[model samples]
Target chain A: MIPVDIPLWADLLASLLMITGGALTLIGSLGLLRLPDLFARIHGPTLNNSLGLGSVLLASILIASIQADRLVFQEVLITLFVVATAPVTAMLLMRAGMYRRRADGGKKKAPQPDEST
Target chain B: MTTLLPFAVSFALIAFALAMIFAGIRLLRGPAAEDRVLALDTLYVNSMITALTLGIQFGDRLYFDIALLIALFGFVGSAAMAKFLLRGEVIEP
Candidate 1:
Protein backbone atom coordinates (compact mmCIF):
# COMPACT_ATOMS: atom_id res chain seq x y z
CA MET A 1 0.00 0.00 0.00
CA ILE A 2 1.43 3.37 -0.96
CA PRO A 3 1.73 5.97 1.77
CA VAL A 4 -0.74 8.86 1.77
CA ASP A 5 0.36 11.71 4.01
CA ILE A 6 -2.75 13.90 3.81
CA PRO A 7 -4.20 14.92 7.17
CA LEU A 8 -7.37 13.17 8.31
CA TRP A 9 -9.69 16.15 7.98
CA ALA A 10 -8.56 17.13 4.49
CA ASP A 11 -8.71 13.52 3.44
CA LEU A 12 -12.30 13.19 4.52
CA LEU A 13 -13.34 16.40 2.84
CA ALA A 14 -11.63 15.54 -0.42
CA SER A 15 -13.09 12.05 -0.41
CA LEU A 16 -16.63 13.28 0.05
CA LEU A 17 -16.28 15.87 -2.67
CA MET A 18 -14.82 13.37 -5.11
CA ILE A 19 -17.61 10.88 -4.52
CA THR A 20 -20.31 13.46 -4.98
CA GLY A 21 -18.77 14.78 -8.17
CA GLY A 22 -18.38 11.30 -9.54
CA ALA A 23 -21.98 10.43 -8.88
CA LEU A 24 -23.22 13.55 -10.58
CA THR A 25 -21.11 12.90 -13.66
CA LEU A 26 -22.37 9.35 -13.87
CA ILE A 27 -25.96 10.52 -13.68
CA GLY A 28 -25.39 13.07 -16.39
CA SER A 29 -23.96 10.52 -18.79
CA LEU A 30 -26.83 8.17 -18.02
CA GLY A 31 -29.19 10.91 -19.03
CA LEU A 32 -27.31 11.41 -22.27
CA LEU A 33 -27.90 7.78 -23.13
CA ARG A 34 -31.52 7.53 -22.02
CA LEU A 35 -32.97 10.78 -23.25
CA PRO A 36 -35.32 10.46 -26.23
CA ASP A 37 -34.34 13.41 -28.41
CA LEU A 38 -31.52 15.76 -29.29
CA PHE A 39 -32.82 18.67 -27.24
CA ALA A 40 -33.37 16.48 -24.21
CA ARG A 41 -29.95 14.89 -24.58
CA ILE A 42 -28.25 18.28 -24.61
CA HIS A 43 -29.27 18.73 -20.98
CA GLY A 44 -27.13 15.80 -19.93
CA PRO A 45 -23.77 17.32 -20.91
CA THR A 46 -24.92 20.64 -19.49
CA LEU A 47 -25.30 18.97 -16.10
CA ASN A 48 -21.90 17.38 -16.58
CA ASN A 49 -20.07 20.60 -17.46
CA SER A 50 -21.52 22.55 -14.56
CA LEU A 51 -21.86 20.91 -11.15
CA GLY A 52 -20.21 17.61 -11.98
CA LEU A 53 -17.03 19.15 -13.30
CA GLY A 54 -17.14 21.93 -10.71
CA SER A 55 -17.07 19.58 -7.71
CA VAL A 56 -14.37 17.38 -9.21
CA LEU A 57 -12.21 20.41 -9.94
CA LEU A 58 -12.85 21.61 -6.42
CA ALA A 59 -11.69 18.31 -4.96
CA SER A 60 -8.56 18.29 -7.10
CA ILE A 61 -7.73 21.81 -5.99
CA LEU A 62 -8.32 20.93 -2.36
CA ILE A 63 -5.95 17.99 -2.43
CA ALA A 64 -3.27 19.86 -4.35
CA SER A 65 -3.39 22.79 -1.95
CA ILE A 66 -3.21 20.57 1.10
CA GLN A 67 -0.24 18.70 -0.30
CA ALA A 68 1.65 21.80 -1.35
CA ASP A 69 1.02 23.55 2.00
CA ARG A 70 0.14 26.70 0.14
CA LEU A 71 -2.54 28.14 -2.13
CA VAL A 72 -2.08 25.92 -5.16
CA PHE A 73 -4.85 26.97 -7.49
CA GLN A 74 -3.75 26.07 -10.98
CA GLU A 75 -6.74 23.78 -11.19
CA VAL A 76 -8.84 26.89 -10.97
CA LEU A 77 -7.64 27.80 -14.46
CA ILE A 78 -9.35 24.74 -15.87
CA THR A 79 -12.53 25.64 -14.01
CA LEU A 80 -12.53 29.17 -15.38
CA PHE A 81 -11.86 28.06 -18.95
CA VAL A 82 -14.59 25.44 -18.75
CA VAL A 83 -17.08 27.84 -17.20
CA ALA A 84 -16.43 30.41 -19.91
CA THR A 85 -16.58 28.03 -22.85
CA ALA A 86 -19.23 25.40 -22.04
CA PRO A 87 -22.21 27.69 -22.50
CA VAL A 88 -20.91 28.95 -25.80
CA THR A 89 -20.58 25.41 -27.06
CA ALA A 90 -24.09 24.56 -25.93
CA MET A 91 -25.57 27.59 -27.57
CA LEU A 92 -23.81 26.92 -30.85
CA LEU A 93 -24.95 23.30 -30.84
CA MET A 94 -28.53 24.24 -30.04
CA ARG A 95 -28.73 26.76 -32.82
CA ALA A 96 -27.14 24.38 -35.27
CA GLY A 97 -29.72 21.75 -34.35
CA MET A 98 -32.55 24.19 -34.84
CA TYR A 99 -31.15 25.26 -38.20
CA ARG A 100 -30.81 21.71 -39.40
CA ARG A 101 -34.33 20.87 -38.32
CA ARG A 102 -35.70 23.87 -40.13
CA ALA A 103 -33.72 22.99 -43.22
CA ASP A 104 -35.38 19.59 -43.09
CA GLY A 105 -38.68 21.38 -43.74
CA GLY A 106 -39.54 22.04 -40.11
CA LYS A 107 -41.18 19.67 -37.60
CA LYS A 108 -44.30 17.51 -37.87
CA LYS A 109 -46.51 20.58 -38.00
CA ALA A 110 -45.75 22.71 -41.00
CA PRO A 111 -44.78 26.31 -40.41
CA GLN A 112 -47.92 28.41 -40.39
CA PRO A 113 -48.41 29.88 -43.87
CA ASP A 114 -47.73 33.58 -44.12
CA GLU A 115 -50.99 35.58 -44.07
CA SER A 116 -49.89 37.22 -47.35
CA THR A 117 -49.71 33.78 -48.97
CA MET B 1 -9.85 9.04 6.97
CA THR B 2 -6.68 8.13 5.15
CA THR B 3 -8.22 4.85 4.09
CA LEU B 4 -11.36 6.61 2.83
CA LEU B 5 -9.50 8.58 0.15
CA PRO B 6 -8.26 5.55 -1.74
CA PHE B 7 -11.80 4.23 -1.88
CA ALA B 8 -13.15 7.55 -3.02
CA VAL B 9 -10.55 8.01 -5.73
CA SER B 10 -11.20 4.52 -7.06
CA PHE B 11 -14.92 5.16 -7.11
CA ALA B 12 -14.49 8.42 -8.96
CA LEU B 13 -12.27 6.80 -11.54
CA ILE B 14 -14.80 4.06 -12.15
CA ALA B 15 -17.62 6.56 -12.49
CA PHE B 16 -15.61 8.70 -14.90
CA ALA B 17 -14.81 5.67 -17.03
CA LEU B 18 -18.44 4.68 -17.15
CA ALA B 19 -19.38 8.18 -18.18
CA MET B 20 -16.88 8.02 -20.99
CA ILE B 21 -18.41 4.77 -22.20
CA PHE B 22 -21.85 6.28 -22.17
CA ALA B 23 -20.68 9.29 -24.14
CA GLY B 24 -18.97 7.04 -26.65
CA ILE B 25 -22.18 5.16 -27.19
CA ARG B 26 -24.01 8.39 -27.84
CA LEU B 27 -21.37 9.52 -30.28
CA LEU B 28 -21.72 6.33 -32.26
CA ARG B 29 -25.50 6.12 -32.11
CA GLY B 30 -26.19 9.72 -32.86
CA PRO B 31 -29.17 10.29 -35.14
CA ALA B 32 -27.80 13.72 -36.04
CA ALA B 33 -24.45 15.46 -36.41
CA GLU B 34 -25.23 17.88 -33.61
CA ASP B 35 -25.84 14.99 -31.25
CA ARG B 36 -22.51 13.50 -32.19
CA VAL B 37 -20.75 16.77 -31.47
CA LEU B 38 -22.45 17.02 -28.11
CA ALA B 39 -21.42 13.49 -27.26
CA LEU B 40 -17.86 14.29 -28.20
CA ASP B 41 -18.00 17.27 -25.87
CA THR B 42 -19.15 15.05 -23.04
CA LEU B 43 -16.42 12.55 -23.81
CA TYR B 44 -13.68 15.13 -23.32
CA VAL B 45 -15.25 16.36 -20.11
CA ASN B 46 -15.35 12.80 -18.77
CA SER B 47 -11.77 12.25 -19.82
CA MET B 48 -10.75 15.41 -17.98
CA ILE B 49 -12.37 14.09 -14.82
CA THR B 50 -10.62 10.78 -15.29
CA ALA B 51 -7.29 12.56 -15.60
CA LEU B 52 -7.96 14.53 -12.45
CA THR B 53 -8.85 11.37 -10.52
CA LEU B 54 -5.65 9.73 -11.70
CA GLY B 55 -3.73 12.76 -10.49
CA ILE B 56 -5.27 12.28 -7.09
CA GLN B 57 -4.29 8.63 -7.10
CA PHE B 58 -0.68 9.26 -8.15
CA GLY B 59 -0.13 12.53 -6.27
CA ASP B 60 1.15 14.28 -9.38
CA ARG B 61 0.39 17.79 -10.59
CA LEU B 62 1.15 16.92 -14.18
CA TYR B 63 -2.33 15.50 -14.74
CA PHE B 64 -3.73 18.92 -14.04
CA ASP B 65 -1.95 20.32 -17.09
CA ILE B 66 -3.16 17.38 -19.17
CA ALA B 67 -6.73 18.05 -18.13
CA LEU B 68 -6.37 21.69 -19.07
CA LEU B 69 -5.12 20.82 -22.53
CA ILE B 70 -7.94 18.36 -23.04
CA ALA B 71 -10.44 21.02 -22.06
CA LEU B 72 -8.91 23.52 -24.50
CA PHE B 73 -8.72 21.28 -27.54
CA GLY B 74 -12.02 19.58 -26.85
CA PHE B 75 -13.89 22.86 -26.82
CA VAL B 76 -12.28 23.97 -30.07
CA GLY B 77 -13.09 20.70 -31.82
CA SER B 78 -16.67 20.57 -30.66
CA ALA B 79 -17.30 24.21 -31.47
CA ALA B 80 -15.90 23.82 -34.95
CA MET B 81 -18.02 20.77 -35.61
CA ALA B 82 -21.14 22.53 -34.39
CA LYS B 83 -20.40 25.56 -36.55
CA PHE B 84 -19.87 23.38 -39.57
CA LEU B 85 -23.17 21.67 -39.00
CA LEU B 86 -24.89 25.03 -38.76
CA ARG B 87 -23.26 26.73 -41.76
CA GLY B 88 -22.01 23.86 -43.91
CA GLU B 89 -18.52 25.28 -43.41
CA VAL B 90 -16.46 25.77 -40.28
CA ILE B 91 -15.10 29.10 -41.43
CA GLU B 92 -17.45 31.37 -43.30
CA PRO B 93 -15.97 33.33 -46.19
Candidate 2:
Protein backbone atom coordinates (compact mmCIF):
# COMPACT_ATOMS: atom_id res chain seq x y z
CA MET A 1 0.00 0.00 0.00
CA ILE A 2 2.05 2.89 -1.41
CA PRO A 3 0.94 6.00 -3.13
CA VAL A 4 1.46 5.89 -6.84
CA ASP A 5 0.51 9.47 -7.33
CA ILE A 6 3.55 11.67 -7.41
CA PRO A 7 3.59 15.01 -9.12
CA LEU A 8 5.34 14.99 -12.42
CA TRP A 9 7.69 17.76 -11.32
CA ALA A 10 8.94 15.80 -8.34
CA ASP A 11 9.49 12.77 -10.44
CA LEU A 12 11.37 14.73 -13.06
CA LEU A 13 13.63 16.45 -10.57
CA ALA A 14 14.48 13.28 -8.72
CA SER A 15 15.24 11.42 -11.88
CA LEU A 16 17.47 14.22 -13.12
CA LEU A 17 19.48 14.32 -9.94
CA MET A 18 19.85 10.56 -9.85
CA ILE A 19 21.05 10.47 -13.42
CA THR A 20 23.53 13.24 -12.79
CA GLY A 21 25.02 11.40 -9.85
CA GLY A 22 25.33 8.22 -11.84
CA ALA A 23 26.92 9.98 -14.78
CA LEU A 24 29.49 11.67 -12.57
CA THR A 25 30.43 8.41 -10.93
CA LEU A 26 30.80 6.69 -14.26
CA ILE A 27 32.96 9.51 -15.55
CA GLY A 28 35.12 9.29 -12.48
CA SER A 29 35.68 5.61 -13.11
CA LEU A 30 36.66 6.35 -16.68
CA GLY A 31 39.08 8.96 -15.43
CA LEU A 32 40.58 6.40 -13.12
CA LEU A 33 41.38 4.32 -16.15
CA ARG A 34 42.62 7.19 -18.28
CA LEU A 35 44.87 8.85 -15.75
CA PRO A 36 48.58 8.20 -16.11
CA ASP A 37 49.96 7.85 -12.57
CA LEU A 38 49.04 7.24 -8.98
CA PHE A 39 48.71 10.92 -8.17
CA ALA A 40 46.58 11.47 -11.25
CA ARG A 41 44.42 8.44 -10.55
CA ILE A 42 43.71 9.79 -7.08
CA HIS A 43 41.94 12.74 -8.67
CA GLY A 44 39.31 10.50 -10.21
CA PRO A 45 38.22 9.00 -6.91
CA THR A 46 38.18 12.44 -5.37
CA LEU A 47 35.55 13.37 -7.91
CA ASN A 48 33.57 10.29 -6.99
CA ASN A 49 33.80 11.11 -3.31
CA SER A 50 32.80 14.73 -3.66
CA LEU A 51 30.45 15.26 -6.57
CA GLY A 52 29.25 11.72 -7.14
CA LEU A 53 28.44 10.98 -3.53
CA GLY A 54 27.08 14.42 -2.86
CA SER A 55 24.52 14.30 -5.64
CA VAL A 56 23.31 10.85 -4.72
CA LEU A 57 22.94 11.77 -1.08
CA LEU A 58 21.03 14.87 -1.98
CA ALA A 59 18.72 12.94 -4.22
CA SER A 60 18.04 10.40 -1.50
CA ILE A 61 17.21 13.09 1.00
CA LEU A 62 14.86 14.81 -1.37
CA ILE A 63 13.02 11.68 -2.38
CA ALA A 64 12.76 10.29 1.13
CA SER A 65 11.53 13.50 2.64
CA ILE A 66 8.94 13.86 -0.07
CA GLN A 67 7.73 10.32 0.35
CA ALA A 68 7.75 10.13 4.12
CA ASP A 69 6.03 13.49 4.55
CA ARG A 70 8.56 14.55 7.09
CA LEU A 71 12.04 16.04 7.15
CA VAL A 72 14.88 13.49 7.26
CA PHE A 73 18.43 14.59 7.82
CA GLN A 74 20.25 11.29 8.03
CA GLU A 75 21.63 11.48 4.56
CA VAL A 76 23.01 14.88 5.41
CA LEU A 77 25.13 13.40 8.16
CA ILE A 78 26.53 10.72 5.90
CA THR A 79 27.43 13.25 3.24
CA LEU A 80 29.24 15.40 5.76
CA PHE A 81 31.22 12.46 7.06
CA VAL A 82 32.26 11.33 3.60
CA VAL A 83 33.35 14.81 2.54
CA ALA A 84 35.31 15.34 5.72
CA THR A 85 37.27 12.09 5.48
CA ALA A 86 38.01 11.67 1.78
CA PRO A 87 40.56 14.45 1.42
CA VAL A 88 42.46 13.52 4.56
CA THR A 89 42.85 9.96 3.36
CA ALA A 90 43.92 11.08 -0.08
CA MET A 91 46.52 13.43 1.37
CA LEU A 92 47.96 10.82 3.71
CA LEU A 93 48.17 8.26 0.96
CA MET A 94 49.99 10.69 -1.29
CA ARG A 95 52.49 11.49 1.43
CA ALA A 96 53.07 7.83 2.00
CA GLY A 97 53.72 7.30 -1.66
CA MET A 98 56.25 10.09 -1.69
CA TYR A 99 58.01 8.67 1.32
CA ARG A 100 58.21 5.20 -0.13
CA ARG A 101 59.60 6.56 -3.39
CA ARG A 102 62.28 8.48 -1.55
CA ALA A 103 63.21 5.52 0.62
CA ASP A 104 63.63 3.33 -2.45
CA GLY A 105 66.06 5.79 -4.00
CA GLY A 106 63.65 6.52 -6.79
CA LYS A 107 64.54 10.20 -6.70
CA LYS A 108 66.85 11.33 -9.47
CA LYS A 109 69.45 12.85 -7.13
CA ALA A 110 69.20 10.42 -4.20
CA PRO A 111 72.74 9.80 -3.00
CA GLN A 112 73.88 6.22 -3.11
CA PRO A 113 75.23 4.65 0.07
CA ASP A 114 79.02 4.57 0.25
CA GLU A 115 80.25 1.42 -1.48
CA SER A 116 83.64 1.25 0.31
CA THR A 117 83.36 1.74 4.05
CA MET B 1 6.33 8.65 -4.46
CA THR B 2 7.11 5.00 -4.12
CA THR B 3 7.38 4.57 -7.84
CA LEU B 4 9.81 7.41 -8.16
CA LEU B 5 11.72 6.34 -5.10
CA PRO B 6 12.62 2.94 -6.45
CA PHE B 7 13.90 4.29 -9.73
CA ALA B 8 15.98 6.99 -8.10
CA VAL B 9 17.46 4.80 -5.38
CA SER B 10 18.24 1.99 -7.77
CA PHE B 11 19.94 4.30 -10.23
CA ALA B 12 22.09 5.88 -7.58
CA LEU B 13 23.02 2.56 -6.04
CA ILE B 14 23.92 1.00 -9.34
CA ALA B 15 26.14 3.92 -10.31
CA PHE B 16 27.98 4.04 -7.00
CA ALA B 17 28.36 0.27 -7.01
CA LEU B 18 29.90 0.42 -10.45
CA ALA B 19 32.33 3.06 -9.25
CA MET B 20 33.36 0.88 -6.33
CA ILE B 21 34.00 -2.05 -8.62
CA PHE B 22 36.04 0.15 -10.89
CA ALA B 23 38.04 1.37 -7.94
CA GLY B 24 38.57 -2.23 -6.91
CA ILE B 25 40.05 -2.89 -10.31
CA ARG B 26 42.50 -0.06 -9.86
CA LEU B 27 43.38 -1.39 -6.47
CA LEU B 28 44.20 -4.78 -7.89
CA ARG B 29 46.14 -3.32 -10.80
CA GLY B 30 47.92 -0.63 -8.84
CA PRO B 31 51.54 -0.16 -9.74
CA ALA B 32 52.29 1.13 -6.26
CA ALA B 33 50.97 0.99 -2.72
CA GLU B 34 49.64 4.54 -2.77
CA ASP B 35 47.49 3.75 -5.76
CA ARG B 36 45.90 0.91 -3.87
CA VAL B 37 45.28 3.16 -0.91
CA LEU B 38 43.55 5.69 -3.12
CA ALA B 39 41.29 3.02 -4.57
CA LEU B 40 40.42 1.77 -1.11
CA ASP B 41 39.37 5.22 -0.04
CA THR B 42 37.05 5.39 -3.01
CA LEU B 43 35.61 2.02 -2.10
CA TYR B 44 34.72 3.21 1.38
CA VAL B 45 33.01 6.30 0.05
CA ASN B 46 30.91 4.24 -2.34
CA SER B 47 29.99 1.83 0.42
CA MET B 48 28.69 4.65 2.54
CA ILE B 49 26.59 5.89 -0.34
CA THR B 50 25.25 2.41 -0.90
CA ALA B 51 24.19 2.20 2.71
CA LEU B 52 22.40 5.50 2.48
CA THR B 53 20.51 4.31 -0.57
CA LEU B 54 19.51 1.18 1.26
CA GLY B 55 18.18 3.27 4.07
CA ILE B 56 16.04 5.27 1.72
CA GLN B 57 14.78 2.21 -0.08
CA PHE B 58 13.79 0.35 3.05
CA GLY B 59 12.64 3.31 5.18
CA ASP B 60 14.98 2.41 7.96
CA ARG B 61 16.75 5.12 9.93
CA LEU B 62 19.14 2.63 11.47
CA TYR B 63 20.98 1.99 8.23
CA PHE B 64 22.06 5.60 8.17
CA ASP B 65 23.72 5.05 11.50
CA ILE B 66 25.55 2.08 10.08
CA ALA B 67 26.68 4.22 7.20
CA LEU B 68 28.08 6.77 9.60
CA LEU B 69 29.96 4.13 11.53
CA ILE B 70 31.41 2.71 8.34
CA ALA B 71 32.54 6.16 7.33
CA LEU B 72 34.32 6.68 10.63
CA PHE B 73 36.02 3.29 10.56
CA GLY B 74 37.03 3.70 6.94
CA PHE B 75 38.62 7.02 7.71
CA VAL B 76 40.65 5.61 10.59
CA GLY B 77 41.77 2.61 8.56
CA SER B 78 42.86 4.78 5.64
CA ALA B 79 44.77 7.06 7.98
CA ALA B 80 46.54 4.13 9.56
CA MET B 81 47.45 2.67 6.22
CA ALA B 82 48.79 6.01 5.04
CA LYS B 83 50.81 6.42 8.22
CA PHE B 84 52.29 2.98 7.80
CA LEU B 85 53.21 3.80 4.25
CA LEU B 86 54.82 7.11 5.19
CA ARG B 87 56.81 6.00 8.25
CA GLY B 88 57.00 2.30 7.45
CA GLU B 89 55.35 1.74 10.83
CA VAL B 90 51.91 2.53 12.22
CA ILE B 91 53.16 2.78 15.82
CA GLU B 92 56.40 4.24 17.14
CA PRO B 93 58.35 2.93 20.09
Candidate 1 error regions (>4 Å): A1-3, A103-117
User: Model 2 captures what fraction of native contacts?
Assistant: 0.63
B6-29: candidate 1 lDDT, tens digit per residue: 899889889999999999999999
Residue A18, candidate 2: Cα error in Å is: 1.4
lDDT of 2 by residue, A68-115 (tens): 888866777777777677788888876666556654434343233343
True contacts kept of 1: 0.79
Q: Where is model 2 chain B poorest over a 10-residue stretch in terms of lDDT?
A: B1-10
Mark the 10 consecutive residues where model 1 chain A has the least summed lDDT: A106-115
lDDT of 1 by residue, A37-105 (tens): 787788998878998888888888888887778988898899889999999999899878776675344
Candidate 2 Cα errors over 4 Å, as ranges: A1-3, A103-117, B1-5
State residue B32's C-alpha deviation in candidate 2, in Å.
0.8
Itemize residue pairs with steric clashes in candidate 2.
none
- Each model's number of backbone clashes? 0, 0
